[model samples]
Target chain A: MRFTRYLAFLNKPYLLLLGYIFLSVVLMNFSDTASLQGVRWALLQVLNVVDSFKTEFTYRKNLEAENERLKKENFYLHITNQRMREMVLENARLRELLNLKTEHSYDFIAARVIAESSEKGINSRVLNVGEQGGVRENMAVVNAEGLVGKIIGVSAHQSIVQVLTDLNCRVGARLEKSREKGIVGWGGDPWLDLEYIPKNIRVEPGELVITSGLSEIYPEGLKIGVVTDFSETDYDMFMSVRVKPAVNFNALEEVFVIKTEIPENIARE
Target chain B: MNKSHLRYLLVFLAALLVQSTIVKYMEIVHWRPDLLLIILVMYAVQYGRKLGSTAGFLVGVSSDLISGGLLGLGALSKTITGFIAGGVSRLFQERSQFIFTLFLGGLIHDLIYFYINTLGKEVAWRVIWFVHIIPNLFYTAIVGMVIYYFAGRWLKADD
Candidate 1:
């Protein structure tokens, strides 16, 4: 009798849920300048704080090890740093010699990946840096490991890094070894598929892929991933190469958003 | 608000924090169980549909905002899930195993989300439904058992 009595109110849950849904939808769509909008913005800031806390929280554990490595590897670090500087100068000289008009240059803002989406299809994750950190939309994200993604959406104190693994993400990448080029798209799996790689081109597995910087989104020379698998058929015009991303999306706790220091006017070409 | 109501709010808030933070470790191949859904279902069943539905909506909205998802999608889905799970609880007696109630409900909840959000025909339905959803169902069911027992006791819900 009690169970049936409750069944009589079964629809009550539905009604209640519907009401809440309606209310949330209404509140979310409420126009700007409303006090509730301010509350919503404040709540978003709370999420950002939580994100930064997650970044610093995880980095704390490895602080000692990182320090130790930095101390001991000073010679190696110095050499690598010198090599990087030389490469930058060489790249600038090459760009100048080619008489190619440089456009859309970016200054990278080093950031930490504070949080990531547990689920895929959701292309958004919170980063520790925001406008205060000099991050902006369309800025590329990478780590020492490789290309992460780009900043699709931003909050004042927090920004969203759309991981390259997201279904909606696409990047212009080229095979470093072969110079084979294609648009890399997330294939709804952990692996990324390099689309439009001509079948005739020889792309062997283990070839490194890097951002072409053909588009304004990412800077040149940033690592993307390594070729893991390639499917080629005589009948197909394109070879589909599966790439294993360098950045471990699963364990990523820190990242750097490649921010171009170039002024907006100079960037737009 | 009554003392008990405030207590429930605290518990719900704590649950949200854990769901957002540490429980992220439970992810398997991008298939993660919705902890908020489980809590909402349990609340809806025990507290009755009205409160359950309201809680569900709140959970959905909060999750969307915190997670930076398509703003209203999670909220809408959770509200419906809360109502359905709560209404379904009337089919069982109070003494049912925690696993039976929570695991089954949670499994169904995830499947619904997978289908609604990603399993459409426009994209590759093969991966979404067959590869992802089926595995996720089993995984969430296992997680649901643990969540059910502990959460049931924590919430002190009779049904």
Candidate 2:
């Protein structure tokens, strides 16, 4: 009677709950069973629809993270690519300079343009190599293109170069075709003025001008420029010649300093 | 089954669907309220301990199976939570203050679930409490109050 009363109070549903819990415990122990796994797999397939929807909503945050990562990667790649291109161009320029040195039998010291004067009227540059690297006053600096400048001042590890465009610069130049010689100097303009050529000399446009080797500063046959314009005044005994320099001074980066010891015969001549 | 039993089943299914689909958007600081836990708490509080424990076991089993979590883990934790909530029901009248019961029940459920989940893991107690358990408790309580208010009305109307 007591058991029946207790059953009635607990209810039929509660009794079934006890039975279900027992079965669930048994199923839990056999969770790795094929049948249970199959059931779990079936339920998972149904639940995956809801999971996919959740993933779709949450994908924006993930995509943003991935975008930031890619942007950083692209920035690094851009810097590296720029550096690689610069290195390739430098390699080619250095190779050309090496060939020029070998062909001319030049005793040369390579130097990089470290700093340039900011003054507008001044055409001067600072090289990384100085007196410590065998650079001296008035040493000729040239590149594969042509004559650049001369070293005017030297420190232990740095030197100052006065470029050909400077008003103070004067080089002994000779016309390639006629062998006519003149003094090349800047006349407050972009072109160099080749002065002291006799009026009778036949100087023409596009004629090659080179170092005459008479000044003891630059070697013979080193290019100065090509004669661009020439005119003779009736009152003057010399022709006025304008020459465009072979080297682009504005874009100068690397250069070679000639360290040849002058021969007694050539120096005396 | 009976009308009440059918009602509970429908509510459970609806809660599960919302938890899976929409509740993620309600997260604050990467924490979301447990809608299914709220529903389970409400059912356990309305009915007796035996019925409450039974509902918890079934729901926990279903959750584990669907989520591919460890077998019997959720069932064991939820069952204990249901039993505790059922025992605590006697201290307060079920109709006058059912929301309190729901909050307490949800808290207990979360505490038990977190404890079981963190076992054997190297997670600190403070991290588990602050990062996971505390935020979830408050969120579940607030959301559960709203659900209970509407569900209570529906239950009364059905009666």
Candidate 3:
């Protein structure tokens, strides 16, 4: 009966505060004990719920960040798709160039058009191949379409070609149908002039022009251009012939450098 | 728990979040107003010493765990602050008089906290009071006045 009265008396406010004080001091001294650590772990689990609440509350913010990431990814994929399309087109074009080499027995060196030197010499272009790679002066440069130019300058690793469209450049060309030979030259005009073809030579419209191979620079039987129009005049001794070049000079990327023969090492390159 | 008790618990959680996230931005030099202490003082003034100390113990333990501080230090200080604040609730004045109790309780709380935290070091009392305790108490009391202006009716409705 006395112990029950004592327990009832300990339930008072001041006595309860003392009990709490004692508990706090004990907790401070034994904070690192395993039992307290277990309690702390339970409290940490409560905090994890708080962390989950924070995450849900910030959902809109995370969505905005995710939106930014997707935008960057979309742009990167767009650029990659465009590059892949270009690669597909290049693959088909390279396959056509490979067929042109197999069709002809002439040993050829494939060179890429590095730059168009239109500022220095009109229609002059630089090639990635050079003299060290067996690109010598006066070697003919062709493509799958037709003849492009001839090598005029060469260094250890690069060569420059004076394309046929230059004002000073002239090619010995022949009409495949009429067997009429003339000097093909550009006079700052879009169409090439096939000079020295007489009025009675009977050169018709849409005639194919091929290199005569009369010069040491150009090889025989290489396509030069097609005759688009022909006009006869009384004062001129030869008829005026306008020939459109078979190769589109504006879209040139790859070409073949060839002569009578090429070295086996440069052919591998 | 009753509705009022649940409401106070939610308010305490909100204060805890704001204290951790936003209070650092409001810090001046090195001293800051303790929001948890202000809530404890206000709650103690309305309630009695018994409920005041209980709320104080819970808030202190939560703060210690969240801040990774030494355990039980905050509980010891806050328990005494709540008890003293509750004792002064019988003063003959309006509810705004609790600001004085807030200042007193704040000073006492800091004394207990710094004393125990520093292992009863009397050498740092001057620096502790002038630099930390005084400024923090002044700011806490001022903020408590503003909070009472807004939420004092909830406490007064019971009386």
Q: Pick the candidate with the highest TM-score.
A: 1
lDDT of 2: 0.70
- The CA lDDT at B2 in model 1 is 56
Q: Residue B32 in candidate 1 has what lDDT?
A: 69
Q: Write candidate 1's Cα lDDT for B1-159 as tens digits.
A: 555456567766766666656666777766666566666666776666577667777777677665655555666666666666666777777767334556555555555555555543345667666666667656666666666666556665323
Q: Please identify model 2 stretches exceeding 4 Å from their true place.
A: A1-28, A49-269, B94-96
Task: Give the candidate order by descending DockQ.
Answer: 1, 3, 2
How do the predictions measure up, each by TM-score?
0.79, 0.45, 0.47
Residue A206 in candidate 3 has what lDDT? Answer: 86
Q: For candidate 2, lDDT tens digit of each residue in A1-269?
A: 98898768455554645655565567558766667656654554444455556556757658989799999999999999999999978877998988743234668999976544322123566676877899876789999889987876665666668888764578998999999999898743357888899988888899999999887779889898889998888899998898999887766768999997755664333
Q: Indicate which candidate wins on lDDT.
A: 3
* Residue A196's lDDT in candidate 1: 90
Separately for all candidates shown, the number of backbone clashes (residues 3 or more apart, or on different chains) is: 10, 0, 0
lDDT (Cα, tens digit) per residue for candidate 1, span A127-227: 76777878777778887798888886565667778888776688999989778778887766577888898887888889898888787677877788889
What ordering of candidates by lDDT runs from best to worst?
3, 2, 1
Evaluate residue A123 in candidate 2 and report its C-alpha lDDT on the 0 to 100 scale: 56
- Residue pairs of candidate 3 with colliding backbone atoms: none
